[model samples]
Target: MPLSGDLTGDGRISPMRSTAVGIRSTRNPRLEVPLGPFRPPGLSLTRGRAGFGSLVLIGALALSMSPAIPATTVRDQEVAGVATTGGEDPGIVGDSGGYATAVAQAHPHPNPIGRTDPGGVAARAVVPAVVPVVFGPRTDETTLRRVRTIRGQIRPKSVVASGAGLVIADNMMYRHSVTIYDTSGALIRTVKDRVTLAALGWPDFPTPVSGAPVEAAMSPDGATAYVTNYSMYGKGFARPGWDLATPKDRVDDSFVYRIDLASGTITGAARVGAVPKFIAASPDGRWIIVANWASWDLSVVDVATFREVRRIPVGPEPRGIAFLPDSRAAYVTTQYHDARRGYPAELYRLDVGDWTLEPIRTDLGHFPRHIVLDADGRYLYASMTGDVTVIKLDTTTGKIVASVRTGAAPRTIALSDDGLSLYVVNYDDDTLVKVGTADMRVLQRLATGHHPVGVTFEPSTRTVWVACYSGTLMLFHEEG
Candidate 1:
């Protein structure tokens, strides 16, 4: 196997110290054609220098006497040294006598040693009179070397870092209280909910909605943290929310509790929409895009004003929202619910400038949930319930060039700092797959907690953070 070498950020090949050599032989000299078509009369060359000296003296006299036999070719009888290896081409070169014999006897066959090349028995015994060691200072030595390290601390199933510190949503309690931990997962403050639906404005509610905050996303300036409350208001006898006495009262409106990070207190709460699942920010950090799964609408909120700017109607069950850089447009995914209904889902291009919504392309696959764009803003990736699809989007034309498959049930995706590979969370398989963006191949798979949902890469930490549906947060380190 070819050992892996550390490459630069630009993907340049940097040669490392190797111990293996690759060899190839040149064509034999016996097959060479004679210098001339015929030999000249009275002209003879000897095998060695001693024989050649006497022959050269005789040949000079014969050349004067023999006018009929034209001198076909002149042979140089001096033994010359030839470099059979090393230098530019690492091939044969003719030079002086003793060196030529030594090189010819030592290297009778082809031998080429690279940095990794293993020195043979003859090469070990014979040393060059003037050994040349080529050395150059490492290019870009100022740049820090990236090394992969194992995460010393085991991540919880789900971590929501809010104003109240880090909260771990654990399934151990079943319809439970949030586990409040410090930055290091040590228990800090646990807040249990005793208030009913009426306290939060809703009245005549039968089954009270429990608090299960799955993921928490902070505002760009780090002032507010929006904690997504993923709770169902029903019992186990039927499907979730099916046993409700009143349908409207039974509907669970997921809340995004806006907590002031600096104050460590809940400042306000916004009723975004039903199943207000994942949250994303606009390029300018002026708007927050929330994906409402049940309503199939993207709720755009103006950050400064803290009000609903516009509700862009998308496809069925929009789960992921990604804003394109340098533009007022955003892309949201409509996850497929039923294949028989031909609801293969699409990416809705929401124009924030005009508050208009249009379907960009609908041909990706079933249940396209999570979406992310490349740093160059050329390609857009949608992770579906079946397979992740890479759609080459022409930003000007608003059209898709091609769509390629990625991984099984890809829920969330994040790009590396260098943008060479994409990290995807496979929710169903509970694994994270690293995919190469250039060739779109699965590079590596990492075991993660159950039902990983939100995926984000932190450049400063060089760690991939994953939020899980099973109430866990996983931190994966990049492999060198």
Candidate 2:
């Protein structure tokens, strides 16, 4: 299986390198590379042999020219926007002309506030894996009410809240491989990422393998959680993945483990490309997309078959991903700036129906990492490592509408249930910042543990959870 590179822009393709079979060491900190001259050697635009489609085509997008947005000068100052009622239009402009109607028909589901159910298994159904949060009236102010800290022998790279009342922290090969907690910030169980691949249908090696869990995404129904491994350790694997890996690196492929939330066991594993970082289940629950860091491609796995259906080549170091509410499109962020080609941090949008990839140029600054869209898919928020801030983008027009100065190295972000409050974790600053979407102002900022990399919002308690790489899980409650 040679690597394909027709879409890497350099037009250089290379054959796959053989793995030097052995278990490799696991490290925690995801590299935050400095901006410099770096050129990607290749990109794999090939679909998987499972055959969703083999025809690889890159379409040039003719995006309408929009005025270049001036650099945001406002930092924490509140720049208010026009107020509107619950059903009134936000007046967001562009191609999503039906935004108002969509917002009107959208019924905001009241979060199960005090539910203590860990989570009940529901019959598997083919529905959207993720339901977009509906925007509600933002009349109430948000403030940090209290903070709770959960300490253990762990180095959490990320924490994900399964809207059904559970939160999982991927401990990145630490003593506790992964930690599970209830919505009330209590520990449920700590699971080790040790699994026998043969039992999961991989007959190549019958022995047990250990994976360094990086990030996780839950299925729409909340019955299952998909966790991506930074690298697999044990038999039949070699060459550990590096954070700043390039095409020249001969890294081994990784796996995405399927955790049955009810049973809390690793039920299945899908082999994906090297250094899989971010994983997301599509809203329609038909696919799971994994961003392969070293391989510079995406593994689009079919949920029904539990196998990769497509391997779409993206640019180097793809980190963050966000999908549209209708599951019609997915927006992926590539962190690497192709200085050789004069390209800044690039954002690619994949059309789900046709699997065509196109770059959506925006003036949202450099090193775009995590991204999240509003309920109506009108506004997109992305954290920029280069800018040390988060910019709000008008998705329809691909222009930065508003921005706020988040602290240095803002890693992951979480949007509130009502889509009115955005939570961001500054890894370098060891703090979490809450921003009001209406005015793009910092509502509050609270100190966190060391290297706070992951952040998530729990709708049940309306609390915020932050995962620190230095063994801490901090929970914060929002008060008016």
Candidate 3:
């Protein structure tokens, strides 16, 4: 629970404060890892600092951006018995003390994308290969002070910002909830619902139910936040054996819950493919696109109506996705760690105009995990896990330009809004890495908490927020 920030967007608002920005649960569903080609046992999948210091914000959420439509209603979800326990204060540091973990190439997480096993399978590769190398920004590391931490969930996946005062933390493992925080990093809402599973078409729910929420994206206007529900609560219709959830795998169709940030309501819920992992909106806010892991497709929804426009088929285990600045093309990365199918993971390119999906010739080898495009949309980056590297790809030529070596297992990859730097979350070593997008060099590699799963960039404050699977959100800001 490393809290950072001063409750303002560029130091304009009052100091941090908290009010009951109440949200009601509408009950919805929800949905990690890194690993290899030849294979390992427990492999699994899935940025920045002032480089905000002694900074802490305490106040009600307030934003300076243009508001989107207010949520007429919100879908609140709740897990039966999940609670938040605070972490011991580790004492603050100023751009100091974290250690960089080298690539051991040893003991990679077996569970790709955070699940037990896709159970081995031979995967098909339909494109040519293109490997690239990432070079400079060999910039140094700057450590930020640990000012505060949140104790609301067990394994928080990712924290999303809306250019407003509120940020949402998607909790994966226990509690299946999303913790909402003000820009100052104070917890405001934990979204969960107690709906009867029967209503969601699941006859089971012999008891009241809740959902496991994963990744989220906000509309351009900052009024609505879209969250992906990974799985359902109360029972095991997911598998044949009768057991609670041990491996963290879900079998049912997931959902996307829309929330009106300002009103604090879980506005609506829409069904998508199974195990929905990542979500993003078109630049114009016309559609909300979701990547469904188990379903092997993308769910495109009408933003204003929340209706499914199409369920576009992708390969398997699709993880991270990003749209070009013009919203013309989207790139998705897949974890080829499926043992049964044995499909080599790859990066798929979807042409927005024609709605066509084709694999991008990538040098990421057999397993590519995450992706993000530059603000200019000329180059795109992907975390090539099986190869233990991050690559910068040329969108025009569909070839690699450069590749940078990373720690044991690299999960998620993000870029600064200016596309000047890349931040990667290396899960196995609990490390956060920063690289200069310009030179393709490793700038900073700092240690994080146990199993860090999610990393998000807040351009408004030039801040980086890291969420740990063990329940903590650490904040950092770029220094001059």
Q: Which candidate tops TM-score?
A: 2
Candidate 2 lDDT: 0.64
**Against the true structure, candidate 3 has what lDDT?**
0.53
Residue-by-residue lDDT tens digits, candidate 2, 1-480: 222222222211112322121111122233543222212111000000111122211111111222221111101222222233233322222221222222223212223332233321223432222222212124127566434566755667888877655778887755437777665444556678999999988999699889888898876655568899888878989776767675678788989988876557787889999989888777666778899988878899877667888898776678778877667888887775352332223566789967876556423456677888776678878887655799888877666788899898888887875567788899889889999888899988899988888888765345688888777788776654
Query: Model 2 off-target regions past 4 Å?
Result: 1-140, 339-345
RMSD (CA, Å), each prediction: 31.7, 14.8, 18.5
Off by over 4 Å in 1: 1-210, 231-250, 336-345, 388-394, 397-406
How does model 1 score by TM-score?
A: 0.54
Q: Rate the local accuracy (lDDT) of all candidates.
A: 0.43, 0.64, 0.53
Q: Mind giving the per-residue lDDT tens digits that candidate 3 earns over 57-118?
A: 11112222222211111112221221222442322221322210110011111111221212
Cα displacement (angstroms), candidate 2, residue 38, comes to: 24
Candidate that beats the other on lDDT, 1 or 3, i.e. the better one: 3
**Model 2: number of clashes?**
4
lDDT of 3 at 172: 54
For model 1, the local distance difference test gives: 0.43
